[model samples]
Target: MHQNTRQRLINNFPRSSAQHLPNTSNANGSSNLRRVGYIEYDMSRMLGESVKTFVYVGYVVEKSLESIVDKKKVAVKKIVCGSAEDCQKNLQEVKILLNCDEHENIVKYYKTETDQDFNVYIAMELCLGTLQQWMEGNIPTIQPENVNPVQLLKQTTKGVAYLHGKRDAIIHRDLKPDNILLKLVGGKVCVKIADFGISRVLPHERTSLTIKTYSGTRGWKSPEILNAHSSPPGNLRAHPRMTRATDIFSLGCVFYYVLSGGRHPFDQNGNSPNPELRDPNILRDRKNTKIEHFSPRIGGYIRLLEQMIDKAPQQRPSAAEILSSPLFWGHDKELNFLVHISNLMQENKSPVIQWCKNQIEEDHSNNEDEFLPGLELNNVGWMNRTCEALDFYFMYESPRTYDEFLTKDLIRAIRNMGTHYETLSPSVKASVGSLPGKFMAFWNNRFPFLVQTVWNVCKVLITDPDFDSVLMFYQTG
Candidate 1:
């Protein structure tokens, strides 16, 4: 840390004087010959009470042959456990934090120590504050707009994906906004997930675990978790299983809170003085899948949240799947995806083309629900009307059928957009430029089913065979 940076961090500490404590044991072997200057906070307003811990700002000082120097700054989490269970939980969090230190989005663990009173002290990288504090206007230095919610959500998803992909998969049972910490890196806001007290590490052979213990905050708990205790014992079918999807549900709520400017999807009026009254309503709404309406500004981003917070845990997308969503794609990436789909459609043997043919056949077989049956390509009136509604440039010669529209006309439009990018309408450019954020709503408004069908088909076909291999088509022609 620079001298100026060190001074700036010191200035942020409360007015109370620092208490110097000598380090007796170096259990982690991370540093040498050190004492910590622990910053004090008022116990009445301490934020770590819920987790049975006390958090403080602390500075590590190393003594050399010459002089003592302030080596590093860290957040010291002290847990005074009253029982064996509490001690085990504290150790679990410390172990998980140390294991996850390599990831940039996770808080870094420096070292751990114990005192004569059996209090566990864990020192980790100090961040500015929690995501809750930032959103609630507690952090005055950085504005909310400076931290792009989309990018923050992407980073958070990456961290969750990392945990799920581990050799022994980890499930963060308590993943709420308060557990996400924020810091400024090169004048840009970066998120760091913290406080894994209730996290569980799954066995190598298992993907999920069923536990009876109730964990996680009320408003953000998944439907399965909320129903865990309600179900009868030994009823495996009714009991909630802890899986990677559990984290995704909480993440969805956090995403909504971030995008909707602190409003929860299940509870619009989250500021109720009585959480007892508010929490049950939120839970009820979540169980019924009754989401509050998001602003039009969020556009199709809500689709991602809906899938994540699905009532059935099995229906929710995995952490890796969430990361692959078009919600995270940039303009260049979206254009590449569209171009790749267009290229695939040109080949008769292409899976994408075959998928479209299959869809047309299925729709035709079910005459009761035929989509735009007998629609002709050269129907200038219908084509113009549809194109105008979709904000698409009309073609002189259109496809003869709806299948042809998918196989030829749609592909031609995508190709033309890429080829004539310079001459396209500003709206068209913006729609493609912002990806699902703008394009999804733009097309969905005109052709809801058609747009969804094409997008889903292309999304799967473009990354064919292996759903894990996301955006592989972007690298191809």
Candidate 2:
């Protein structure tokens, strides 16, 4: 052990637990001695494993002569270095963590310790799991109902922006979902960037450096890094000059995975026209591929991804640019409103009847032109969709009470259909004449309670003069 390490143990440790108890002369010429090694904890539970290390969840006692440590959990990363050269490289990673101050999105660093036997242990705040694991469990389709892609994209971009905006910008060479740690905060999940082992800090100047060592995970490396060796004979110096654009490409892949619910954006498996979905290392002269057959609903996000993973690195947007893009903020407002309707129905029963009615009126007032057709109801395509929603709600719901009918959005949709029907010319209205039996056959067959909800929604059409004639004929029949 070095002399400094020996002193550190002597100064920091309790006198009673020291392996070598130092003797000293007191003021009265009496001898005083101190022993060390009081702090103790077991690094037994294995949390995770990496290329050169094993992370264990453990706790340590501090400022106590007793060997008992509190039960608060901490992740202990044990890095095994066989040679001094390997040890120095590992220490550089620790220095980077130390330099980065507290950031909510970046993994929290606690402290570092080294043993005389050349084992290094770094303790950090514990997280539940990784973003990769979460994705594996919650698979999303093109029309995502359960997952919120907007929230995921916003949080991920925030982390990248912080890293790139630093004085000496840091590029996370391995920015896969697996490196993102997830923690539950106030019933919502948040992500933190972890595993900075292969990260690189760019110099203040934009000058390129020739890095011989390859870094990054498969399917996420940028085109420049993948085609580094394919440069022209005179351009040997261009092979390893990686820039911030590399990270942008990887981030694009991440966004694809989240938005597609776990499908690889570059995946050409199935009917997609892109070549192969495999790693870039295998294809030396690989052609640049584009995202194919993505859903039109997520087109905004897909457009941003296209710009991010562009073949030319210069064309890719910076992290800040991506954060400010319209794609990041764009989400279907109607879909969100439907989600709110679903939640309002599920959480309460008594107040939801009035709530649903108020929401429908508010939505119509806010988007009057959207629900109202230009001339007539039957002239627009939404007439069929409104009828479909009515049919679906009536067929699926087995509500015991009228207030519990699962037709909130559908009710609003049908009301818009009714309003449009009232505006048609008498000649046009006479062409399609039936009223009561046509729209409410399935609804009327329901139990008494269920029939009331549908009756309340259709009552609005009684104000129409032609509809009153049709209703009088139906009521007398």
Candidate 3:
């Protein structure tokens, strides 16, 4: 909203803009998202310890129609890359983030730009330090050499909820303490979720792949995900199907570290009281014992965490289910207290959202679909066509037709999805419910052509978009 930021949005918009695509609409066609002017705020600042040309980024400033760098005032994401794959991966992550939009707690993206030398830069809010730093500090010193397990689980729940209910169910594949940034904003703890570049979308097909290389730190991979068959590990394995449960495993590792005062579950040098990690399955057998004996604040939460990091892909919890779990109930009062304070502050500031405030009087007079509540043509037909680059990703290879857009890779994704859905625990299946209605609908409709060779496709479901509801009031007038 600053002056320079305003100017940036105007200057940065792609020239000779294409016709705006229509979004899903109910009666009056109001669900469509309009392009807006915005500024790209300065999200870069030199880090004191980092030497990899890494800059602490600030959020993008999308005010009206521009991209401008802001002064080093607000927190942002740190942008770094080592290759072309990293560059492509960065943009892919951005596209996913754009679809996700904003949540009160999720880190924000104001503007993105490419450098003079062709390197891409993502500008966004930066956090002060990771949770690992804090745990290694006074919190560990004050206690009787023990950590507050309850507080740890509560914070994790708070963050996971923001990703789940708050921001369209994003799965943070690597949930270790080092990635959890703990900051002091206005004297209150403002936990900002970071490192989405390595973060894979579990149910959503995000994260581009080139080589079947191992990603994420060694200690964090799930048993199934860890390419351990070869010496030095991960040398000769077929690329594994990424599932929603992969993140659950990573979260378990995170929970283990947080509850145990920054000590890694897979300790290498054997410097702590804990036993050494021989294999990834150590988490599976030791989950209940460790939670019962070690943690104070997060004592009971570990059982819930075990459900997430299950050794089997089918055993883990989806991000959505984790939020609704009884284990996170203690976190409820804290979240509500904060939401109440937020509501009171907002009540003092403004009114409820009126997205179609500019609705025309005459436009309300013309709508044949007013009789139908949730039915409407999804002008967002481009969901499939627009993302043809990921054609095989939706229903990738196998018995599928070689000619169709949704290739073998995508068909595999669809297959993995059905397999995961059917095999998941009841709680997790309930959690995976109705997340990708439009995309699935688009994929399912394409099957006779796209997946003709493939048989036994999963059942499809698509929900009425909220955008359609907005159009109703205006079109029915």
Model 2 per-residue lDDT tens digits across residues 1-477: 354754464346221222322222231242321111221224445767877788776543344357543444567677887765666567666655654525677888765655544556666777877777777763232123444666766777788888888887788778888888777666566668877777788877864455555666777787676666466546667665787888888888788777665766566542342324545522442323332334433532344676787767788888887765434432232223233334434454544346546544343223223222231123232223333443343345323222322245444433333335565445434433334333332222221111222232333444555335324312210
Best by lDDT: 1
- Against the reference, the lDDT scores of all candidates come to 0.62, 0.53, 0.43
On TM-score, who's better, 2 or 3?
Answer: 2
Candidate 1 vs candidate 3: which has greater lDDT?
Answer: 1
Judged by lDDT against the true structure, how good is candidate 3? 0.43
Could you give candidate 3's per-residue lDDT for residues 300-418 as a string of tens digits?
A: 24445556656676887655555444333322332232233223232433222121111211121121232211111122121244233343333443233332222333333444444
* Clash totals, every prediction: 3, 5, 56
- By TM-score, the better pick of 1 and 3 is 1
lDDT for residue 152 in candidate 3, whole number 0-100: 47
> Can you list the residue pairs that collide in candidate 2?
15-35, 17-35, 17-36, 18-35, 18-36
Q: Quote model 2's TM-score.
A: 0.57
Sliding window of 10 residues with minimal summed lDDT for model 1: 367-376
The full ranking of all candidates by TM-score, starting with the best, is 1, 2, 3
